[model samples]
Target chain A: MDRPIGVMDSGVGGMTVVREITRQLPNERILYFGDISRCPYGEKDLETVRAYTIQVAEYLVAKDIKMLVIACNTATAAALEILRERLEIPVIGVIGPGARSAIQHSRNGKVLVLATSGTVKSNAYPDAIRSLNHNFEVTSQACPAFVPLVEELRYKDDIVTGIVIHQALKSHMHSDADTVILGCTHYPLLKESIRRYFDGRKAVIDSGYETAREVSSLLNYQRILRAPEGEVTHTILINGDSSRFKYILRDWLPELKYDMKEIELKV
Target chain B: MDRPIGVMDSGVGGMTVVREITRQLPNERILYFGDISRCPYGEKDLETVRAYTIQVAEYLVAKDIKMLVIACNTATAAALEILRERLEIPVIGVIGPGARSAIQHSRNGKVLVLATSGTVKSNAYPDAIRSLNHNFEVTSQACPAFVPLVEELRYKDDIVTGIVIHQALKSHMHSDADTVILGCTHYPLLKESIRRYFDGRKAVIDSGYETAREVSSLLNYQRILRAPEGEVTHTILINGDSSRFKYILRDWLPELKYDMKEIELKV
Candidate 1:
């Protein structure tokens, strides 16, 4: 029960959720797996995404992770339920928390979700929201360029990020929805660009923060909350070293120091 | 199409919606009716609330108003559909817009809806939200003391309103929800207090702004948009003069000046 919580995503993007878990539940240790070799899962078919997610999840579970968190929306939409049925530990998905967060703040009961094409094609958010409150109107757009914008740290270069974000969300500029969800885990890195484009006209939400809250809630309700006085440490593993897991995380979360390990994916 | 838009609420609380409309659609003229004598309709039963809303809507229709807006959530919950069916002009409700806004901004997918016991009992927001996206998790709590808190201008005195708001929302302090809906029209007046209590953890959305955006969208879509170049004037009417309509309106929106007329609700 005191084992580290397992968190996995397609790439360094899952760091967003990792950072939140670190902030909200400081006492808990984290075991994060980034399938950096697969990199952008958004472009893959459902089966491929699921396979990659399963591989990463299995790796984390073997490491004796107590809980599983699908930090990437694509993986959640593709593999969460299956992993839940297959794994004994409690499983959490980014989409659910993000969708929940978006629903909670939208004043018009209308929402604009910006994820990847795979997520949009899967109709993940709409389906999830419909199951929770079928009366909400959902609009989703896939931003193919966003993940790169964040990974390259282009978001820090506002002018370029703004252009990409505005172009990605242009059609829904004056959408009936006055709130936008950074549906993809990586989208949180593009938060400034998203906020600047909406310019106070809309509220922007993220799954990282909400998912962290959920992790905290689940931990408490299940009576597995780590002791506050205990020393907490975290581990990051990447399938390949092509991705900048440490550099990006350190930039966004300079407060935490983490040592990352590079591991091989059997497949 | 050039005629004034009709807006009504059980009391001056609906003025929040009116103010939003005035700000968002500056060129459109508004004719608002507040049944001040029947203030605090949150305590009334559904049938009575429905009847009161019908009468008010009818009165506005009789005024040659182009569009009808049920600015009170209770009235909208009780009568929006029926009135929409009965009236030829477009009908709008505060609840739908508020729910939409809340859904759009919530990061946790959990929403805390604060309204009068009557509005909460009517289940208007939940119904409307469910109609759009059933996946939302909604929590509705009625604050019987909120209307008076705003009407008495207690919010201006943070020390007073903060205490009242904190007490009202304390039970849901760590609610799974990361967003709060100002479910009642008057609750917009209590926003700062509500925000302060939640700190920055949750987004506080007001139906007033959402309703205004909806009105604007409806006008454009219905092709009833008034020419911006035309001279626009507004009128406010209350069933009783005992209410402090002028003082509150002027205090909140000094830029808007409109003559008031006294009317009566037969029942």
Candidate 2:
């Protein structure tokens, strides 16, 4: 089967996952969809989230993807179960991988989840972590403004960013967590600031990396791993503009060559 | 008579212009398109830029927009003239407005143009500035990595961000320019950092704001300004997902409610 592994996010934030996926499964071609149109699913209602999630999933399925990775935390929280049930292929979400990693890595058994409002409200990470290790204490913080702040590329604005991160991490800082799970894929973009904020106190976990590992394991277990014979290619589809998305891929995956093509997704 | 103004960019960066246009022209509704599919037109070649620009323009024109704002700098440089000639409606680009603003604001008649490699290479701002005032000395710098850095939301990652910005702006810092025009739409997302980088030494001119002003003027000149009677609404269309885009919009334009709708643009 030469079909590609499908990964989707609200925007390029999922590129983090696609980058990891490429690194881990170099032989497997990946199809990544960034719904840059309806991105930052953090603040939308559940119905709207489900609608967009289905739209993207349907579009990717139409592309003949072998598997689907809900690379977005918000979408995973809102529609992962539904997608897994509805789609023919196996469906994976970032929440489980990230939560499991946090659970496995937490020294103090207190793990902090930094994610969008929708993710936190759904208790997706907390539930995933608890299911893996019942004794793990998962504290979730809704960093509603972080995505936009990052999206707007305000990462270097010390004063504004410092204030925002400080506000978002205030509750987490007071908690006894020794490891932080970047629940949302976009959170990795703010890793430096996040690490600095919790500097020396906690280890920051990237969902993208953990999810990639999971994908590798699942593919191997299913005996679906492609032989590293053919040249590995990654096709990135943006239902918006491919210009900025290409640059983002270059920045995040530096080693990978991004072939961004425009695709119109019917909602 | 109640038709909305069509504004398009490679990605969400154009929301800066959309926000301004909304603020300035409160009576007019906006049908905004962020070609999130092929965004960040800065690094792409001319042929690619022209093709993408025309694709977006045709999509917007099909929506029956009264005017078209090529809110993206690279697209403006690559396809503004072609669009103006091809379309029956008045077409405005950020370059002219940005140059006009830079010329008007520069106290010493020495202005700096900061944009993507494609836009800078096109000499769009320089051409526009010279057209307005021949004596104006315009220094242009291609901040290639800036857009990707911003898109990755690494603007707050102090070390990496500082290094990138320093490298991109190093050449311009040594110059005699007093006013720096953020020639690219995406550049505005990095405005705070860019401003902080050149703190107290120069005034940062945002092309989006200037473009909005020009858009207002053109509408007024064309006698197409909608009467301020009905409720003013803004419809945001993203070719990807609306969630993340909404987050950024809420942060950038706090007061406006962003009704995000998914748009499938036929290329």
TM-score of 2: 0.49
Task: List model 2 lDDT by residue over B1-267, tens digit each.
Answer: 678899988888888898777654556789988877676788999789999889888888898899999989999999988887799998888887777556545778899888899998998888766643456788888888987776666765888888988998877776778999998887787888788888758989898976775565456435576766646677778788666667676666788855678877746
Listed in order, each prediction's TM-score against the native is: 0.55, 0.49
Interface RMSD of 1: 16.1
lDDT of 2 by residue, A54-77 (tens): 988998999899889999999989
User: Clashes in each model (backbone N, CA, C under 3 Å)?
Assistant: 53, 38
* Location of the lowest summed lDDT over 10 successive residues in candidate 2 chain A: A216-225
Stretches off by above 4 angstroms in model 1 are B1-267
Interface RMSD of each: 16.1, 26.3
Docking class of 1: incorrect
Name the TM-score of candidate 1.
Answer: 0.55
lDDT of candidate 1 over B174-263, digit per residue (tens)? 877888898999988878778878877888889887777656645643558666655567898888884477878878978886878887
